[model samples]
Target: MEFPSRDLELATRQATLESDTPQIVGPQVVLGQGGFADDDAPENALVAVRDQSQWYVADSLHQARELAGKVQGRRSSLEPRPPLELPEGDWALTLRTCWVEPAYLETDASWCNPQDEPADPVANGGAFGGKIASDVTDVARELAQANDRVVRVLWSREDTVRHGPKRPPVSVGLRADGSGIFRLARTDHIDERIRPLLPKCEIEQVTIPGPPTSSAIRGAGWAEVEMLRAGLSGQAGWVTAPSGASAKATIANELISVEVRAGSPLDWVMFRSYCIGAAHMAYSWVTSEGLSVDQNGDVHDLTIRSFGVLRSSDTPEI
Candidate 1:
């Protein structure tokens, strides 16, 4: 993401996709267990402070673990209210990036529809771009209207993984001559993301039936586009955003060096952190990050623990 103002934003992303695997989205890394995430899933903090002041958002049990990441400083444990009881198969996705908890709920209007009121649970931006069209608020509104009570819609990690959309997977074929075409799911124009950085590439569309998918997650389609290009050209390439933010990532020495630039940085901490995070994710996606699916399109690994995310010990250096 880039800005016309003095704000520099950068991110990196990469994920492995098998040429033969079906274009299906399933619980690969995050093998969900009882509630949200698997009981064995490790703990990670979105808001970590050096002073040890704690604010835990989603927990092991409540971990939707899709993209709702962020925590804060000390405060009374304000456990949010429970969502209205909706029957089975009643939830929706991608209505708009929404969180299970509503920060504000004092609506003057009673039993209103979506147009009368709109809520934004996310304070900053969408969660890693993964929550592009999350639908928590819509569910809350429906439950509140139907049950005549304040409702909170919390999706367990299982609900998120099983129901939430994922970054669409891509299939590409490269020739030794540094020229080839890449195939994507329905309506994905790989050239749109790759053209600025990589000049010439052909795009082929295929109808690979699969789960909910999107191209907006973090690096969106940029990282994979470059990875495909580098794999064929055997050289380094840059990443460009429609907003004009750009970064040069070299694919050599099995080590990566990225140089990012934003027109002007409004917030260094936010911009740089996301940039670094994006870089790490992109690197991992290029090197690892894949899923195993069966003939029926079921994901075998449900926990991120099983994901190919490189450990700190496994990574070399920035």
Candidate 2:
């Protein structure tokens, strides 16, 4: 599964031509899945172990405690697994959806194919990138096909953080007055990632080895870039959604105010909550949070306590 850099360049070019769309470029590789396993059945792990180079078939951290008596602290050695084989795709394809929220359509529209359920973007809202749970649906469906039994695929917070896709870490340089000089990252498709949002800024690519990084998380990389650009430009940052939905906001003295226009929010509470959550996430990510990795591309800080996140008092109320 890979969304190559060249493809992102093209997506960005196309997105650049249309100013109304969100700068949402993605991996050349899409994890394509179906259902919940039986409660009594053996639980499956869905994680990508960095050192072992393995993905999606480990014990969830929540379930790790239960293994204490069974394994008596016994641990297995790391053994690298080969990447899964998937068909090639036309990376040249591009899409633009902005100001089109309250919109969704996916799957075959027939219940006869359960495997296609996770592909339902309209109903799920896809939780930004959190909707990767669709991967589990595929795992479960495959197991059910082989053994004719329910195979539940689940993971804990630790498993998620460890294996999940991340907002690509960036290297941004700014002048004394906040004008950006360069924003760089190997994990991101820089062509369409930040440049589209901050048209005046420049970005360079720096090679670095690590686990998968992406723009799929909530607002992801573009959010941070737009916010930074907002500070530099002394104006509200512009935002667009895949659904063609859009919003604008400005931050002064650490306070944020947003105005949105998105096809009439269907549910006020859900729409408000979703926007608030994303705002909080974007604020936290741009202002206080970051991940640090060691020389071997291993993340030294694994526990939540080590993430050094902003305290509740630090977060402003709307």
Candidate 3:
């Protein structure tokens, strides 16, 4: 499934605009779902505005503006709450939650173990395989809390990006004999944010250590590690197998608007060339060895080339 990059971009833009004005002009409508599996589910539509010197949720933009007007009319209630402080050093946010239900059993066959079944058909898995999970709900709750004045507001893009859950970078080690026979494979992934959100599987993770910056992103440490393992495995050999494998990823907040325009083309072309070269080499290796299938249907000297592409669309606007 695709990531919600467009929605996030729009929301970030709205947040920036709202932060600029001193008085609450209108409700700021930030769009995006917070929880896991929210892609197939309804997206959370948040409208935040000032109310009596504190932030409050307005169901709609109009309602938010009305509340802001009322707050302006009043001289003052309690002093305005202090702005939330951003964390120092790089940080990222992550959110997650989980739910489970039982279903009936139609037919049963077991490996020497017996079990009872529910009466109704169980729709057990996620909408899109394992894509949907608790992370969505966790993020939703965090956003709601921030909007409701339970937590301090996130005021800037730098704060949001640095303090949010970052996509963990990964490294893989692969070994093969001189003839390209697969051997040992090892994968490593590090979530620099993990230390702060200790013991909380469903967490409002932040790379920066502190209280005010407690919002969540989509997947946390486990997801990053699992994805890295799968990705490295696929890179090593899965994509070339008779039964091919594929992957889809959505990266958020990696670059500023300025950097995206400046860096995308060079990155894209280099990656594309790498993929083409790798595919060609793998194919050539497989064909040249003539060690195709014997009577036993076995082949030798198979070389799996690890390479990939991050291509740009032909349309420059893309």
Candidate 4:
């Protein structure tokens, strides 16, 4: 896997600056597991300070100064107070320019129920791009009723993954009769949290009690099912069999192989490419027996670069 080179460089620079400081207050240090580093620690007074006492050292120089201001405020004894007024406005929106494909709409549609009305119809795009539309709507309706003002709802990608409904994981058991015919039994472990979130679907699900990670991405389950189905069918040698009665006779007599490999990108990329090429060949064989070239070719590949600066003060309140 490719490591974060740019992030490491910034971290190294911050470390060099931090080494200059002899000591930091307990409340002025923040420790995080991953992502950007920021010093948003609670305020405490520095003891035994000399004339040249270092105030702040941060990943970003600007952030260091911001931390100095925070530390200064904390050191000065003052009564704790909240903001007197909240900022009021109809905010402008901007989306991150990521590799988002319009064709990916299928995944979004599968997760949301169009018939279900948003809780705050005025602000329809609720958290996580409608990943929790129902829940958001419910909250918005309640808030709107209490405060007779239009409330706008917005969802960040992170929020969507954290709180949005997830696709349930499924396990399938297949028994082949040494013939083309196979018996399949599927068991799906549906998340109880998502039961209330999703509209009624055709599949009957069994609820399992456990702590499911909220970071489960979209189509998390379908990929596994597709892999299993492909392997099972491939093992049975169903791909090579001719159509009609002859194919039926060979189905029961054929042997199938199922192989699973877990590895990093460098270890598996070549194998993955070979598998994809084979799959395309198989598709051509099934659809047009003699077609040798790809019909839908690659259009274009594009890359964009940008810079993101994270300050200690900008850290999210978890």
Candidate 5:
């Protein structure tokens, strides 16, 4: 059987500051040997796991997953609430951050010893800001000191799905004059973050009993607004980040073409990879990825596979 080859292209930047090089760990990562937080733990380190119930000791991955399932089964179910009300306008939209968890391969992990500070929760790959407030490091340190031994605190797949921060779901209404209403799930600083982007739109931050939300998710509040405005105007979607990076994307015949200018990238190889990745993420989020959450705010998709992430075979050429 012949397999198709995937190629990488390094486009020239507008300005050249330094010669670019492939990431040092690229080969290791491709070969599945990147040093993750848990893999770097001491051989003698004890394992710890947590869920809604509480933190507890686990001897292995299987045991940890089993414990998490038990904890999930014990939580009380809530009555589903009424559907979100969409504001009336020329264009009304309601969007959910269903498949928004970072779901990084290395489910939150950290290690700590009695004599040293806790290991960093993030090792090589990032968690898309989902791990910014993770308590695994603190728990690892506490367990290590109490047990007087090296300890590795890890989050099971279910735990990550339940505890990770999600992109805030939003309801938007846009008028022909570019003024409208934007209703967002309650989250910190979300209004301030998006005020400048859609100043004419009335931003309403509503409290809902759902998974915790964060503006840190890739273009959480503003991206929705930009896409809506672009769609309404029959123009390509345009988005600008706080870091001065900007991108435009358009969809035709089921293909999304994107153009980005992030200003003089440090590494063209990494830049190309990131660009392709972002495109893939956008494609998957729209077509394949999503979580099944109840109206009561309980997440029904607990397993990593349940989130409907697009597999490599199912992904389109980017």
Candidate 6:
């Protein structure tokens, strides 16, 4: 028997806007049975927590948290931040202090035994690109081998907020003809990723003292540029992803309208749910979410409550 071609196999799995299948892992996740990284850890796994610049292994999560509290970090002064300067233009926006807390419910977690490599930190759920460079796996391996036992490393909410990568803040000025200066927090090769999106705008990366920024974060630089362009033109346009998925969104009168075309959407219900979640997140990011970094490069809004994520009641209909 002859095997089907790759294209033929993929074509057989096409989906439509009307498809109503559930997400593959929905039930398991909803029932709390999804095998998260920490779930299947060894029964005698040593919990590793970070205290200031040091790592501490504890008998339990409560004890680990208590150890973490022993080295309480400095609080921000909340001083008035200096303003960012942009060249004069028709539509200039100086967004010096913008930040996004990923706030992914599952913090960075990893586990390892002396005889094997570290388990994946993102075994289940997602980090929204926040855990791409997380050091927890390496730490787990080191601790497990050093202690000659299974070890699990987990970051607390505050630890996640302090160390997770952030979307780089922007300062921009746009002319009537769509030519202007785009300034962003410095990150390696970020300008290259953003240059194509803002070909008409001069891209300049500036060094800022705060949490490290990542170009890998969802739409880090390009999204900001697109929003700036839309605000300047008073019109929103189609946004196309590298994978050919495209969407156009508009918000007016407390309602959000979106049109998306993603090939082979497998499950329309899941797709729609994700889109609605993205809409809510976008709304929250614009209306309330932000991080306060002081002059000394410390993140002041460390707690989950302080991020100002929108409550369900405050979210607009999508």
Local distance difference test scores for all models: 0.42, 0.43, 0.25, 0.25, 0.68, 0.72
Predicted structure 1, TM vs. truth: 0.56
Please provide TM-scores, in order, for all candidate models, with all chains considered together. Answer: 0.56, 0.55, 0.21, 0.25, 0.81, 0.85
- Residue 299's C-alpha lDDT in candidate 5? 74
Q: Which stretches of candidate 6 lie over 4 Å from their true place?
A: 1-24, 70-84, 87-97
Clashes of each: 20, 22, 21, 8, 0, 0
lDDT, model 1, position 307: 45
Off by over 4 Å in 5: 1-24, 58-83, 88-99
Per-residue lDDT tens digits for candidate 5, residues 102-200, read 566768889999889997776554566677677889999899999898888988777777778887877677777667888878888788777887778
Model 6, residue 199: what's the lDDT? 81
Candidate number that wins on lDDT, 2 or 5: 5
Higher-ranked by lDDT: 1 or 6: 6
Scored by TM-score, the top model is 6
Clashing pairs in 6: none
Model 4 quality (TM-score): 0.25
Q: Residue by residue across 25-144, what tens digits does model 6's lDDT show?
A: 434566876666787898878898986598888888778778777544443445324224565666644344476678888789999999999977666544666777789999999999
lDDT of 1 by residue, 1-318 (tens): 453433222211111111111121233323533122112212331111111122222223234222344232122223211111212222221011111111111111112233334244332234454444566555546654554444334443333444455555555444554345545554344457755654544555555444455565555556666565556555765656665677886646766677886665445444566556666766665555554433344444444444456665676566
Instruction: Point out the higher-scoring one by lDDT: 1 or 2.
Output: 2
Error of 3 at 31 (Å): 19
lDDT of 4 by residue, 150-174 (tens): 3223222222222334323332333
Off by over 4 Å in 4: 1-133, 155-158, 177-206, 209-224, 235-318
TM-score between candidate 5 and the true structure: 0.81
Per-residue alpha-carbon lDDT of candidate 3 for residues 73-126, written as tens digits (9 for 90 to 100):
211122211111322222233111111001101111001001211111112211
Q: Tell me, by lDDT, which candidate is best.
A: 6
Q: Order of candidates by TM-score, top first?
A: 6, 5, 1, 2, 4, 3
